[model samples]
Target: MSVSVRTRALTAADGTLSHRYMALRSLMKICVKRRSVVTFLALFTLSVVLINTIPLLPKETMRLPPRDLKGSTSKRLPAGTPSTLLDLPPPLNGHKNKLFSGSSAIPFKQPLSHSVKAPVTSQAAKTLNSSNSTRLCQQKCIRDGGGHASVAVGEAEMTQQTVREVSGEETAHERKPDSFWKRRSHSFAGKESIPRDRMRGEKSDLCQISVGKWNETTPESLPWLSAGDVRKMAFLSGGVVLSKARVPGHGQVLQVGLGAGEAEAEAEAVLDHRQHCQSGSCALIKRPSDWFEVLAFHLDRVLELNRSLPSVLRNFKSKLLPYRYISGNARPVVWWDPDIQHLAEVDNDQNSFSLSWPLYQKVLQSRCGARVSLNATPCVGVQHSEWGRLALFDFLLQVNDRLDRYCCGFRPDPSDICLENLLHVKCKSPNDLLLVHILVRRADPSRLVFIDNAGRPHHPHDNLNFRLVEGIDEFPERAVSILRSGCLESMLLRSLSADRELWESRGGAEGLRPIIRTIQQRGTILLQHIQNRILRLNKDL
Candidate 1:
């Protein structure tokens, strides 16, 4: 019996061991079958973990190489190098620009009568220098927050390709050298040294033609709340001196709110000629106490037009405004704030393009359906919006010196003007050109205040009848009915109020009749002109 038990135990052990061996063999077979997929998954997980663990690095900053004004744009100058566009004549054939690429010109201003010389390299540089001068200036302007900027593109690599989706008739150019910047835009591009009179400094003892004797009072005493208040305050104050009411072309632009170097851009207009004024033109201190400015404001207000920029005639003096006319032809030149004259041009892209006053004039002069670009979007020059209303404003005021005028001081050519005439402008997009109702949505309201209402001819025939406005006919009754009304005298007198003698050479009430009559006669002529234009338009259509 003991022998039988031992034999049974040994057999059971052998059977159990055989079962374990079979299970282990089956597991090995399963592992071998799925090995490829498992191995792939393991490798993928490892890669993902590694990728997640690695830190992302910041973008590397690229410092622009110094400029080589010589035809070659690729070469870099040594550190701390000083160079200028005037250093080398621009190549006769346009070269690559450092800041702007492609063949587009960076627009600059020339006085209305002045034609700037295209003397640089007769060849324009295709590439803009990113570091040193023009390019740097553009970059700085863009960084000012309200300005626009573009990515630096190399001209050698870019060819002009028309994008079809831009709509309308025109395609945008990239500040091309061939079209816009025929001449260097820098303030010092053509010359050197910012002479003192040409310099934008403060004036003291501003020359004033005081009509009545009054105690001296501070400019702060003047309330800018309304036209009457402003005139009243200016009248109560002693006649302070006014000085240097001259710009390159228009002598009417007087300095008021801003002083020399108040803004870096303003300083540049003084220091460099190429740095165009923020406004294509400069600011002026217009005298509404003369009431022409107030008259304009009142007319626009009653007419519900856009010509008024809130103005106050205040007697103030600055160090730069130190010229006091003791005698002679010096009249108290009117003073207005160019700063608050909410008229800024919407230059889409060309760094301060609207500042190129004459260039835009050329654009305006282009046929009615002319097209341009702002922010790479195609913007057509149609006679349908606020731009058209400006013509009416100019027509009413008899303003001859619009953008172009003969300049004075150092750069005395008609191409240049004193910094005071430099306008304050901002950029606009093609999107801003909506229906007149939505025009204010995407665009800044163009309060084109015609502060330079000085020197308007007493008779309209001298100004209104001879020259015609561009888009005058297209404006509707809402825009023009005020010009035709009999209430113009009331409007003028209302604005003049207690300071009625200031309107004309102090003949008191009798002096006002002819001026009012002249305005009424001009209104009749303006209506005739508009009717004629509409009739002609019907014929053309």
Candidate 2:
């Protein structure tokens, strides 16, 4: 039995060994297959990398000319030209006279006075005199050139002498004084000539000659003057008319021309003359009606301000006066006022007067020193919460009472008063807090309720949780849409937190953790309110 057990154990051991050899061979085959797969993957990855890197290598090489060639070429040529050297033609000889012949004959030196020669003959002299006179007179006034005046006087004398020789008849026409003064006066009025010798009294008669009569009388009087009488008169008067003829009624007519009620044609002529005249005495006069119109407009605005004072006072008290109830730790809010002293008195509660119609009239009188117009229309008044109403009544009564005592004055027209527009009052005093009040009014076009700060519109829907304080009235549609959309919460949070780096570096209001936390909490509530409102609206729709 022991031998048979031994044979069976040996056979089992051989079978177990054969099984272990087969498993070992299979394991080797799997390892070989895995190694081959890994090797193939590694080789494939390296080829891809090399293929990608090949295009990055440089494709071209450049060669430059030698330094000596470059330097020699640059030195021999002008800048920007190709640097090629070349031979030139020989210089010309015996051309000295050709260079200097043409311009040498003309002398450039100034001639001496005595060396200047006269015209050769009497005809030439006459020609020269006439030509010089004509050139001197070229569109210039007779008074501008003394040479032309002298020539004109000589020609006139010569003409008179020739006329006396030809006619020889002395008549009453010849005895009459010449109309030269009348002509001069008319021409001077037209600014075509200058009136000279006014202060010397020699031209006094000429000045008295009326511009209007001169234009009419010249043609009628010319036939009465005889040539011999004119020559004798000219000889006695230095060959020129000295004393001007006295024209009847000329002074009265000239006075009438200067006075009001002149015809439009005459006035226009006078204005044209005045505009062109070199004299500094003439000036443009402003009309009385225009001046009155400007004054009326200015006073009208002042009156508007005066009439609107009661409303503004009421609004101020209702909307802004309660800011005093806020905690001392709250952010400092400033109010600007036209009168600092009056504002202080009101703030201190020194005035506790009740506001009534009679009191309003008295307060308006005391502040503006003018009667309020009964015809003035009232602006839309404030719609207030309970807190707002109590605050406003107290504020208005205080302001009114203070105005009755300490305020300087109020404007006649509130529209023109533009308290905020004034430089001295702009956002300066506590009473000026009117700037923050948002006034609600009826829109001109859409007739919707509008809220405005000062005069600018603010959108109410922009901040849904934002309660309109007593003074605010105008709200924009876009702002309302934003609030309805529930986007303002995220916007407010981002705006408040965005300047973190600046806050950290400067140590400003960023450290006010309580205010920041309050704002964040308020934003969350606002968002929830907006969402709820939107859902309700959607359900209703």
Candidate 3:
């Protein structure tokens, strides 16, 4: 029975073993069919284990002290060292840096006119001398409180280079030569030596001149002329046909008079016209746009009380005159004064008395007519009061050709005859600076006869020829009072209105107002300058 039970158990064990072997065989077949996928999974698992085992950062680097996000300082970057070495986390600094808040520390560019040397800061100086690259300097600046100091450093470097170039330290190849006008403009010192207003008024008519009908002739148009001068201008304009168009020595004036055919007519001309023009009954004609002469005459009568030539606006064509002199535009006509004494163009110095910059200054100091002294020399002929009047008048009209013939008072462009003719170069030696257009009459040597009354109406107020009044320690009290009256505009308007031609030529009162305003503003500046000068003199006394 035991043997039989053993056999059965063995049989059962064999059957169970055979069933397990069959199951293992079936599983092996299935694994063989998907062997590629199973191999890929095993390889992936091995790679992941290898990756997990390795370290990204060095042990010492990873063991850094934890930063205090709440409030604590970290190691600062060394001076002249790059801040980009370490990756910066979000700016955990509690306070926001105003400079870095989407704004540059300093403007990158500035106008050349207003540009000045950039002030060197200690930090910028250090950066300049540092051997590090510019990027390193920029990074170091950024780390210092995030002030955005990089821009300042860059600007300083650029400005220093520019200064070096301007100072002639740079090679000539690096710089181009400046123009004559540019050099003169820069030499002006921007601010006038005399005091001026800080805030200027509107510049609507600062350098503007009026244009009008050239043929407009009426009593209203010739307002600047007296009843007598008016008749002379009318006669010169149209009453009689002109003959003999000859050029005068001093100016572009054309001398015109009756032909031989009309010589009898000249003697029989209107008795009043003959009385108005006694000097051979001739007239000098100027260009149509030469309104400056007319303006000067009116200003002489109204402001300085100086004796200027009588000029009137008139327009009339004559076959005898050259076409260049006749633009069909109304031109200025002045009565010929044959008796007036003046130096001929042949003389080296055209003025009756020769004067230079240093000489003029010495004459002003001598106070010639005020106190008699044998040493007065050239100052003897000129009246002490007359100098003040001349200086005041020249300053108002900015007639630099007379006193400041070298254009030392203001910046002169190539358009100016003084600069164009290279006369300004003589200003380098003040002793050699000679005065021109200083006129006097044969009848009276005491007073000055202003012949070339063509004033520059468009001269800028800022660039006014103040050098005309440089040596004048005193100004005419009457002229000062007139400027101070505050009615200068009204007085000018009223006086200008008398000349119907000038009034209508300048677009009437509307066009005249702007020019009048510019003059008024200049008057205000002159008043201030006078007051300051008086105070200074009083202090010195």
Best candidate according to lDDT? 3
lDDT of 1 by residue, 273-293 (tens): 212223222234443334455
Residue 246 of model 1, lDDT score: 50
All models: lDDT?
Answer: 0.34, 0.24, 0.51
Per-prediction RMSD in angstroms? Answer: 25.0, 42.8, 26.6
Error of model 2, residue 471, in angstroms? 13
lDDT of 3 at 259: 25
Best by TM-score: 3
The digit string of per-residue lDDT tens for model 2 on 154-190 reads: 3333222110000011111011243231211010011
Q: Is candidate 1 or candidate 2 better by lDDT?
A: 1
- Candidate 2 has a TM-score of 0.15
TM-score of each: 0.35, 0.15, 0.53
| Cα lDDT tens digits for candidate 3, 340-416 | 66555566435776778788777776667655552457574776556767876777777787888788768897888
- Worst-scoring 10-residue span by lDDT in model 1: 198-207
RMSD of 2: 42.8
Report the number of clashing residue pairs per model.
Answer: 84, 40, 9
Query: C-alpha displacement of 478 in model 2, angstroms?
Result: 3.5
